[model samples]
Every structure is written in structure tokens, then in C-alpha cells.
Target: MPEYPTALGASSRDSITLLGKDLATDVMGEVGFGELAFWLATQRRPTPGETRVFEAVLAALADHGFTPTAIVTRLTYLSAPDSVQGALAAGLLGGGSRFLGVTEDCGRFLHEVLVEREPPAGDDGWDELALEVVTAERAAGRFIPGLGHHVHKDGDPRTPRLFQIAREEGLVGPHLSLFAAIGRVHPRVLGKTLPLNGAGVCGAALADLGLPLELLRGFALLARTAGLIGQLAEELRHPVGNDIFLSVDLNNRSVPPSAQGGPHG
Candidate 1:
């Protein structure tokens, strides 16, 4: 069984081992929390420089306004106090797929495209092989992954930045180049240039960074959870809020209640 380096030791309450480093801190943000977070995941305790990178990432990904997931997180907090974790969890579920799930698929695609090449095929061959693989996969009842996004018809801006960072870190290798080759081949659908989205680029970058496939989503969850908390906190601050707006009956249908529910007279 292969172990996940990114997920060596993660506990719900405190501590996680990143890159052979042990990080111990309370759940609440405290002094040197950022340092602790980096140490936990990357081992060897983060240098001031490394800690700076981690902080930048944390801040950049912390929150986006009124995204459905963000909105849901804030709304959850308005009605129920002490559910910050729960609200964050809900948002995390939506995001993990795009970050980790998509990354895994993109990595797979990148690897396949590389394997399918013979004798260092040129750009044309890379595209040709990718299209062939995609068509064959679709024919085999598998959808081509990391090719589309719900929000952006043209492209995902975040994708390039992540790739650029990974490249600067010397992490992008054959795996990423393979994915880039494929990404460039995608002709615009709906008259839109569908560039590699967050999932695709992150997927390739993580693979090149030597992260395990199973641990991709977990890392992403860890990162984005920070943002979710911020949204929850912001929503809680505003007083004018109709928090409990559950339209249970708006599209509700009554079902037979049995063991779970006592008789309501």
C-alpha cells in the first residue's frame, strides 16, 4: 500500500505531518499558528521565507465574495452558532472536488498523454494523441476530465498562476508538460477558449510536486477551510440577517415517517 506523503498524520483536532515535519497547534488561531501549519505539513519547520509563501497562499485563498459555497457557509453560521466547523465542512465538500479530484484526473491524463507518445512526438503529435485518448475514453463510457467548468466559459485564470508557481518551484516536470500540451489542443467550445481550469492545472502541478493522488483533495480541503472560516465569521458580524430561511415546504413532499420520528398528533 502506498502512503500519502501529504497526509502522513492528520488529526481532526490538532497536528498533521507534512513532508516529514510535525506541526502541533490548537484549533484556534494563536501565536505562530502559520509557522506551525507549515511545519506540520512540510517538516523541517518553515523558514521565514517558506512561512511567507504559506501565509500568502492562505490569504489569497481565504475568501471569495458570494460564491454559492461561501454563501452557504455564512448562512449556516447566521442561524446556528458554534457551527463554524460544520459550515466550513460543507464548503470544503464543494471545493475538494475541483482542487483534488480534478487534479487527480488531470494527472492521469497527463501521464497517459506522455505514455502514448512515441519517440518524443512534437506538439502536433501531443495534441493528436490527447484527442485520440479522449475520444477513446469517451467511447469507453468515460468522460474527458478537466476540460470544462461551470463558472467560466472562456478559461480559469487561477490555473495559470498555480502552474506558474509550480514551474517556478521547479515542480512541473514531464507530467505537467503533458497536461499543458493537451490543454493547448482544446478548441474553443461555445465560441470560447476553454483554458485549463484550477482543477487541471493544480492536478498536474500536484503530480509534478510528487504528491500522492489520494491526498490531493485532503490538502486542498485543508487550504480552503481557512477561507470558509473567514466567510462564516463575516456573516456572523452582520446583525440584519434572515438566517433560518430553510424553504422546507417550498419544494417539500411529505414521506411516511416511521422509527426515526415519533408520532406527531
Candidate 2:
């Protein structure tokens, strides 16, 4: 027989263990989902402050009202009402560069920048470093991750709130310090101010929490899972999927193939 080792969860005939604790007696009702999630990822319990910041990140990413992911989820549910899992999976599959994936992208990007240098001494140093980073990225023709938002051109409410929460918790580590500096200084290089979007800020906060850079997107997805469920529930009550499908289906006009290659061509 072969043995597989894991510190996560194990099951026996009569009992179950999670993170080395009895799942039913120790984990259930004793740990909140957010804390349990944090524990599951890092295999160590988080402080109360860490839990608050982490849960805040989860809340920040949860739902954004009629996003493509929500739309796809509702549409998938409409198409296959028999398979709720399929609907959820459809939405989760949409977590990519333009959407929830920014959480991971920003975290990894900030981590990479931090790995190359020491922590800045203060906001002034961070701003100077951010200026250098923005200038280099501009020269390279690369967009700074977590810098802009499509909807909240003025500002992302979640961004500042998350920053405040992290600050209050004394959890503003180098990643967040750098991200905030970027928010303040990027306009000098980019020639315009852009709101530091919520997803990007969540990334920074998670990075500051020392969460795995690779699993940053996973956290975003986890948050959005609740949102997707809400979408599906609202879809049942309000039922917009059909109207959405019809709006596109009825409005689209058939045109001849263009000189440039097209999907039909």
C-alpha cells in the first residue's frame, strides 16, 4: 500500500480531521469561514487583525453587479438549469487577466518589484521607488497592474477603505506601501491620474498578509463565489438572462465579411 501525506484533511471511519483538528468539534462553529480559509491556505491560524483584513479583501472582491462573470453564470444557469455547478464553474472560468485575475497579477507584480530591492524607509522613499517603477514600465510600454478602473474613474471606494483597514491593523507591509506609493506617483509618469481599482488593492492587501502569490486569484474566486450565488438567486427572481440573450440576439445585424479577417470569415 502507498501513503499520501497531507496536513489539510483526513478522514477515518468515525472521525474527520482538518488542519490537525477535529473537524466537527473543533473546526465547526468554532472557526469562521474566512479564518478557516486563511488557515487552510497557510496552515497556520491568523491573528484577529489578519482575519479582519483578509475578510475585508474577500468582501471587496465578492460582487460587482452584472459583471461578465455574473452574466455568464446566469446565462449558463438559464441554459442548463439542471446543473448549478456548471453555472458556477462557468463564472469561475471567466476569472482571467481583465477580471478577478488582477488580484494575482498585482500581487505577483508587486512581489517581483519588492524582491529586487529593500523596503523603502518611508512614504517618500516609496514614492521615489514607485516613480522609478512607473517610469521603467512606461518605457517598456507595460501598464502598471492595479492602477486604473473602468467604472470608478474618480476613485475606487474599496481601495482607500482597504488601505485604511490594513493601516488600522498595522498590516501595511512593503507590498501595500509600494502600491500606495504607485497610486500617488503614477500620474507623473502616465500623465494622468487613475484610480487604484479594488481588485488591485485586494491583491496588495493579500500580498501584505503574506498569502501565496499563486493563490491570490484563488482568493478572488472564492470571494466571487458568494457573489455568483447571489447572481444566480437574483436571476431566479428577476430573470434577466433571457432578456440579455435576446437583446444581443435581436440587435445584432448580419454583415458581410470585412477585409480584415473576422470570426465568420
Candidate 3:
């Protein structure tokens, strides 16, 4: 007989194990969802500071008004009308390198820098290392993940606040310090100051807390699931998916011959 071993869970007569811990007595309702997520992903309990930072990250990413994911979910819901799970999955499916999934890349980038390079001695040392890293990324034609934003040109409001909270909780570490240093040198290196995006900030913080890089995107996905649910609820109240569908459909309709490019070349 062949058997597979599992550390995450197994059902029993009277209890269940999750990540090698008692699910009913140790976890159920006793911890916040964010805390539980961290535990399940890493198989270790989070510290008070880690828990606070994780919760903050989840709250920060839970919504972003009419983002592509929300729009896609609404449109999918309009088409299917009854498949809420499908709509949610449709939205999540769009998460990739440029979108919500960038958090994982950002975390991995920071982890590589922190793990492979010697810790910079002070501000100057950190800045120098940041410059080296940024320059190499640019040379490789890579946009630094977790830096810059489409709308928040000057800075991402959420990032500084998150950093402040982390500092207050004494959760600051080399990963975070290096991110700050990167921001400082970014303008000189890239000809524009790239403020830390919210996801990037969370990535650095999570990396500092010793979380696996693979879990970074999962956190973003979980947080955005809440945001998507809110979007769906609003969509139910104020229906606009039909309008969107109609607008797109109308735009794509074939133009009459007279209306095609001023009627003549």
C-alpha cells in the first residue's frame, strides 16, 4: 500500500489538526483571520508584532476602488448572474506579474538582497548597496517591484503609515531598512523617486518577519478577496455591469461603410 504523509491536517473522530496544531481548541475563533493565515502558510505562530503587521497588510490591500479585478468580477457576475464563486475566481485569475501577484516578486527580490549580500553598516552603506541593486535591475530591463505607482506619484500614503506602524511595533529589520534605502537612491538611479507601493511595503515587512516569499502573493490574494466581496455587494445594490457590457459591445459593433474613416481615403 502507498500512503502520503501530511503535516497540515487530518480529520479525526473528535478533533482536527491544522499545521500540526489542534484546529478546534487552538485556532477556531481564537485568532484573527490574518493571524490564522500566517500560521497556516508558515506552520508557525506569529508574534504579537508579526500579527499586527500582517493584519495591517490585509486591511491595507482589502480594497482599491474599481480596480481591474473588481471590474472583471462585476462583469463576470453580470454574465453568469448566479456563479459568485466563478466570478471571484475570474477576478483572481487576472492576478499576475504586473497586478496583485507582484508582491511575491517584491518579497523575493528583497529576500535575495538581504540573504546574499552583507548587511550594510549604516545609511551610506545601505544607500550604496541599494544603488548597486537598482542599477543591476535596470540593466536587466526590470522595473523594481514594490516601488512606484500609477496614481501615487509623489508617494504611496499607505506605505509610510505602514512603515510607521512597523517601527512602532519594533518590527523593523534589514529588509525594511533596505527598502527605505532603495527609495532614497531611487530618484538618482532611475531619474524619479519611486515611493514604496503598499504591496511592496507589506512584502518587506513580511520578509523581515521571516515569512516565505511564496506566501506574499497569497496574502495579497486573500486580502483582495475581501475587497472583491465588497465590490460584488455594491454591484448588487447599484447595478452597472450591464452598462459596462453594453458600452463595450456597442463600441465593438461594425461601423457602417459611410462612417468608416471619413468616408474616403
Cα lDDT for residue 20, candidate 3? 77
2 against 3, candidate with superior lDDT: 2
User: What's the TM-score of every candidate structure?
Assistant: 0.64, 0.97, 0.90
What does the lDDT come to for candidate 1? 0.59
- How well does candidate 2 match the true structure in TM-score terms? 0.97
lDDT of 3 by residue, 1-265 (tens): 9988987889889989888778888778787788888887888888888899888988988888878898999999998979999999988887788678767878888888878778889899999999999999988998888998888988889899989999999998898899898999988878977778988888888888888787788888899999999989999999989998899888896756664567364
Question: In terms of TM-score, which candidate is strongest?
Answer: 2
- lDDT string for model 1 (175-244, tens) is 6666666576545312334566666666566555555566655555666677776666666676322543
Clashing residue pair totals per candidate (backbone < 3 A): 5, 0, 0
How does each model score on lDDT? 0.59, 0.96, 0.86
Q: How many angstroms is residue 55 displaced in model 1 relative to the true structure, after the best TM-score fit?
A: 7.9
Clashing residue pairs in candidate 1 (N, C-alpha, C atoms within 3 angstroms): 18-40, 18-41, 21-43, 62-227, 103-203
By TM-score, the better pick of 2 and 3 is 2
Q: After superposition, how far is residue 17 of candidate 3 from its true place, in Å?
A: 2.8
Candidate 1 weakest lDDT stretch, 10 residues: 22-31
